[model samples]
Target: MIRVQARTEQSRLMTFASPLLAIVLTLIFGSILFTALGKDPLQALHVLLIMPLSDAYNVSEMLVKMGPLLLCAVGLSLCYRANLWNIGAEGQLLAGALGGSAVALAFGDSESMWVLPVTLLGGIASGMAWSAIPTYLKLKFNSNLILTTIMLNYIALYLLIWAVHGPLRDPMGFGFPESALFSDAALLPVLSDSGRVHLGVVFAVLAALVAWFILSKSHLGFKIRVYGADEPAATYAGFNANGISWFVMLFAGALAGLAGVAEVAGPIGQLTPNVSPGYGYSAIIVAYLGRLHPAGAIVSAVFLAILYMGGDLAQIEMGIPIAVVGMFQGVLLFFLLACDFFIRYRLVSSRETVA
Candidate 1:
């Protein structure tokens, strides 16, 4: 029989090794999934991992997809570190798009270059405002944030659907459910000629660096770490858990919102019903896969971005469903969590008993 041996102190070696193990496991299963689909596993793996890196154009596209992922992951790291489960990033992202589009459509043509900044701010504020509801409920009524945040995402999605279909829909768009295209000044400038890589990458990178600094170096970061490690100890040390909760949710929501705006203003350049293909949700995986570290999140974000690109590639090359991509992501998360078992406990084998 296999038994788990709990360690006195969590093994730091296993802590880091787990992600590596997870990747290996994911690859093993992914190959199986591809083969089960009647596709060449090696070719699928090559397209999923290698093809993206081979072309400069694809590289730029990967960076474009990575931008919002990094942004959302950075914010999520804060909330995770503080032990605050704010899972409404998807809804928060939509709220940001709605708010930013409202601003951009209203004043995109104005002579003031301030429209872009104001739009960005509006998006961030919208995301924060949406997040605050659950935060307040959790703090005051002791509500389950997990349930509230998830329900809020659906609400946000319906709200966006309503706006695009009813109020915010472009009048001259031939009845399409989308806002008008943004002005040149309202759009984020492209970083290169080959693809849609834009200034959002810079923002995402900066957000990661800032998150790293705060979580690793600052006093508030220390408080958050303490609170995550031990709430009683944090309270004993004079840290207000409620305050930290609010800050973490707001900050995370803001970053997620900013990512939404970046997606619209940089690549899409307009509000649509489908502003994201679950970027916010995938970011949850990014946070854990990165082990809740900003630097690690960056790496994971890029890796996930490749998965996104690979999904498209697979669809084109192998007639694979897009769900295959999501399956890959799910497999990564599942294996990563399974690998986490080795961090604090080791497996041992003993005699098997017949039932």
Candidate 2:
């Protein structure tokens, strides 16, 4: 028999090594998976990982994908640091998109410079309002935030679908479940001529930098760290738990909302029934893989964005299932958890245990 034992002290090196180890394990798993699927594992790996960055266009697309992942992950990093498990970034994102689209639609053909900014503001407010509901439930009624946020994700999705099919549907488009294309005045500026990269990328980077500053340097960050580390200590120090929760959740909602609106106003240019390929869900993995650091999340976001483009490339080149991308993300998360577990504990053999 084997016994699990906690180490007296965690290894500092493991903090950084765990994600790398997890990636190695994920790659090994992917190799086996590809072999079992009757595909060449090496070729599949190349297609899934290397090819996405082989061209300028794909690189630009990866950055486009990175914007939302980074934005969502940065916000999530803050919430996790505060010991709040907010799981409704996806819903908040959808709410933002819906809200922004509504504002954009109201603009019709107006060329006012305020169109874009107002639309983005609408989206941010929408996202904040969406997140506020669950935050309120958790604070006032002591409800399970995890459950409430998860449920809201579905609610938001369905609500967006309803809006697209009902009120927001484009009348000139033969009944498609989508809003009308946003006018140029309401859209994000393109960053490059070669790809769909847009101003959203700048917003994501700025958000990450701001978040890093907040987490590492600010008084609020200290309060958040203290609150997460020891609630009793925080209470003794007169830190308001409810206030911190509200702040982090609202901030997260705003960033996620920005991401949602950016998508429609940038690459998509319209409110579609499918506005995201699950960027919000994927950001959870990026957040953890980055050790819950905003800066680290940027790196992880870049890696995940590669996988996003690679998933499309694999489907087109190797006839691989698009679901493989989701599988890879799930596998990576599992491995990361396993690696983290090992980093904090050790296994004792039967003889060692007996001794």
- Candidate with the greatest lDDT versus the true structure: 2
Give lDDT per model, in order.
Answer: 0.89, 0.93
Write the residue-wise lDDT of candidate 2 on 1-355 in tens digits: 7889888888677888999999999999999999999999999999988998898888889999999999889989999998899988899999999999999999999999999999999999999999999999999999999999999999999999999999999999899898889999999999887889999999999999999999899999999999988989999999999999999999999999999999999999999988999999999999999999999999999999999998999999999999999999999999999889877888888799678
Task: Judge candidate 2 at residue 326 and give its lDDT.
Answer: 97
Q: Clashing pairs in model 2? A: none
Give each model a TM-score: 0.96, 0.96
Clashing pairs in 1: 1-350, 1-351
lDDT of 2 at 303: 90
lDDT of 1: 0.89
Query: On residues 50-152, what C-alpha lDDT tens digit does candidate 1 reach at each position?
Result: 8877888999999988998888898888899888887888989888888888888888477577878888998889889889999999999999999999999
